[model samples]
Target: MTDFLNILLRFFHFSSLLLLTGCLTYLMLLTPAGYRNRLEIRLSPALRSSAGVALFSAIALFALQTVMMSGEITALSQPDIWSAVAGTRFGHAWLPEMLLAAVSFMLLRAGGEAARYLLLVTLILQLILTAMTGHAAMHDGWRGVAGEVSQSLHVLAAAFWCGGLYPLLLLMQQGQRDPQDNTAVLTMMKFSRYGHWAVALVILSGVSNTLLISGIPRHFSFWLTGVLVKSVLVAGMVMLALLNRYWLVPRFRQSPAESRRRFIRLTQAEMGLALGAIAVVSLFATLSPG
Candidate 1:
């Protein structure tokens, strides 16, 4: 069914988006934080490979979605479809994503303090741009630009909060890969502080976004259900973030063993929830702006 397939695409899109967001956080935030902790990160060969692969995967998926959505409207198909991509609104929207992804790849491959700093800045920018492409910023002219700014802040913050999940999960799975190794613990502390800052920004941006999108005049009934779903999911994400900061980080810093296991379990769940939220976001983006 076209409907089912559309939903499925959205599901995959969201999953991919969440993973991409997390990757951004990992590459930008978690990795650097590890260095700051004075723990020599094993930037193992596999880790470097993943950096390239992840960048390519995110770019490919986003491009695919743009082309597919544009294909139905235009007559472009197959090899010619790329031109359709270059000429469409979706294509225009995709330009920044492609550019950022390119930068991400280049920086990731370079691998140094300078490259890491650039990567973090780029990740923060991409998250903001991604949010701007959504319905919330589709209106409001000058105000809309401000909306994008707030939105960028919101997305960057959320990505940092949620994206840290994978890196933390990996650390947990290895379970005291080095108990005395203060690197993981130090990294965790940095992220804990960063996560709190992100939460505050998320709350502020959320209020701004809600006010902009929903008002007395525009009764956006179509989006009501999806918005509610997003709200609940965001609440859950905040809870997980809190747990990571208040409960897990301190425990892990101390009980290294139990902390590792609990962190892994929670992160796995967090990943699923993030994916589900992405699905909702993709669907919401597709709907007509009411």
Candidate 2:
């Protein structure tokens, strides 16, 4: 039950935070200036809601970790145990995570261009802090520092690519409504322009993180199986994205209606695969990497 709760909370936390990061990236960077305000306003409720979920999940994860560390249900009430937990490496990371999460929630609630910019900064910091607590922190000295950096990049790249899909769907809806509006096409082109880099970084840093966490497994293990599954799922998403970009996009003008239906369907599948990948990560993150 404890383990179950741990994975569940981690999934929720990761999903919500990833959503916030990706959607914000899409709004600030991908969407055109004319569409930014409307998109932001439309997305505000979801942004704030994700922030709230992230903050609460961070608190719950901390409490759960305390119990895991102290091996007692009452660890939360024991000052000594709390202090001990706080002194650990996870504690170091969680401290800043909690702080950033709180600030992010407040900023999202405040709502505005300025608040969003601030929220983005805080959320990026929060993602970086995440690298400090997990398998990336296994090494010491320079190697550890390098691992954290790689892991941070991995998280950022993945967040930007996967999280941006939500807004992309919204943008597609607008295009569907106004056949004359080329905003969605232009925005998608913008996303594809930079998204290639994001995808490459996700793959590169993911490999780096895996190597840093545990070298090639000579034997079968749950961790190895999870990694394989995740790789396959990600590969599926990449293939679908390529099909949409190369096969459908060029012919969009020739058959806008058909292209729209296909693109939306493919994008939805990609989102499902992304969620599956996240679920796999959440589960295996708690297991031994070896």
Candidate 3:
């Protein structure tokens, strides 16, 4: 039951991060400066809501973790559990994350150019802090710092690519209304460049994480199986991304309507694969490391 609760909380935590990161990435990187008004009208509410959810999930996860560590659900109300939270590595890592989430939620709700940029910085730091208490933190000395950096990069890259998908899909949907509008296509083209870089970082950091946590071994293991499944899902997402970049985007110039439809479909497919990958990672987090 404790394990079940842990995975459940982890799912919410990861999902919230994806939403928050994706929304911020879209606003700061993909959306055009001239489109700021459109973004405020169309995307601000969603971003604010995601920020709220992210903050709530962070607090809930911290509380649940305290109880889990104490080995009793009732520990939720116990002083000892709170004390443990104050004294542990996980708690130390989570405290800054929770605070940043709170600040981000407030800043997103406030809604201005400076606030949005500040929210992006806060989210980036929060993502980095999240890596400090995970499997990476289990290592010793310099190896531990390397693990933390690798895992941080891995999370940031994954968030940028996978999280950006929902906003991209939404943009595609909007483009379907005016198939001739090159705005969405142009934005996607720009994003594809970033996506390529992000994918490379994710792969390199993933390899580093594996090496740091569980060096290549000949035997199969449950954790390794989870890793394999995650890798496959990520590969599927990349294939869909390539299809959108090379096949669908080019088709937009020739057949805007058809390309818009296909782009939406492909983006949704990629989003599904990303969600599956996140679920697999959450499950793996509950398992013993390979």
Candidate 4:
């Protein structure tokens, strides 16, 4: 059962991550644009529905993971008074997930950007605080707070760019259904700009995280490996983003149909990288790297 539980946690963690990508992408980028009549015409309702389900599954799976990770797997079988989703470490984490979950439901039902923005804020808060409860922050002094913030930013930024790739790729695959949709390129630029911001913070925060850990020269092997892995992922994402913005995106803008297709492929690839990074993150979260 312990093995099964581990498997369950891993599966749910990855699934929630995929959903989280959509949730963050939709709320931060797509939601507002969608409200302003900016979405492509061929983005079929089916695609939107799948995104919603993905987001919903992410929250539910996360809640379950929280239950298990919080060391409450056995408690889950206890009476609702103690074992409930609202009464454990899972509950603390669930607060934001639950709120964001509601936001996704509303977005689907009401169909607007306001819901998206609200959801984005909630997701950010949840993610930010989520890292704080971990050993990285709670175990250290004042400096740890900054480390925590960076780690959270790192994750959030990764989700924004990485998760956004799915929908972006999907949009691209739609084949420039709207020849005049400049928003596609605009969104690409937006992600590039955001990627720059994520990178800056990632570097600064990474330094702080290094300080908390045994330094590069000291633990050059395993300790540095953790940070190095994340750095490589961030670097790759940044390069892809740069190419998308300056190179492919410009060429794409000149040709609507082709640009959409390119964006879709890029988004798919971005998501794959983001998932790989997160898988590494999950292991790091479970271990004491130093």
By TM-score, the best candidate is 2
Cα lDDT tens digits, model 1, 146-192, are 77777777766666666666666655554466666565555666677
lDDT of each: 0.62, 0.88, 0.83, 0.57
lDDT per residue (tens digit) for residues 1-290 in model 3: 76776787677777778767876787687888887567556776667677777788888888888777877789888887888886889888898889999998888777578878888889889889888878876888999999999999999998899878877777788889976666676777777889899999998898889889888767788988898899999889888888888887777768888888988998898888888998999899878786
* Clash statistics: count for each candidate: 1, 0, 0, 3
By TM-score: ranked, best first: 2, 3, 1, 4
> What lDDT score goes with residue 143 in model 1?
68
Ten contiguous residues minimizing lDDT sum, candidate 4:
35-44
Task: Give the better candidate number (2 or 4) by TM-score.
Answer: 2
lDDT for each residue of candidate 4 in 177-202, tens digit (9 for 90 to 100): 66655555555566566666766776
Task: Summing lDDT over every window of 10 consecutive residues in candidate 2, give the lowest-scoring window.
Answer: 108-117
Model 3, C-alpha of 284: deviation from truth (Å)? 0.6
**TM-scores of all models?**
0.74, 0.97, 0.96, 0.70
* Model 2 C-alpha lDDT per residue in residues 1-290, reported as the tens digit of each score: 78999999989888888999999989987788788998888787888789989999999999999899878889999888878877999998898899899999888778567877888889989988888887877899977898999999999998999998888887887787888988888989988888999999999998888887786667878987998899999999999999999999987889998898889899999999999999999999899877
Better of 2 and 3 by lDDT: 2
> Which stretches of model 3 miss by more than 4 angstroms?
none
lDDT of 1: 0.62
So what's the TM-score on candidate 3? 0.96
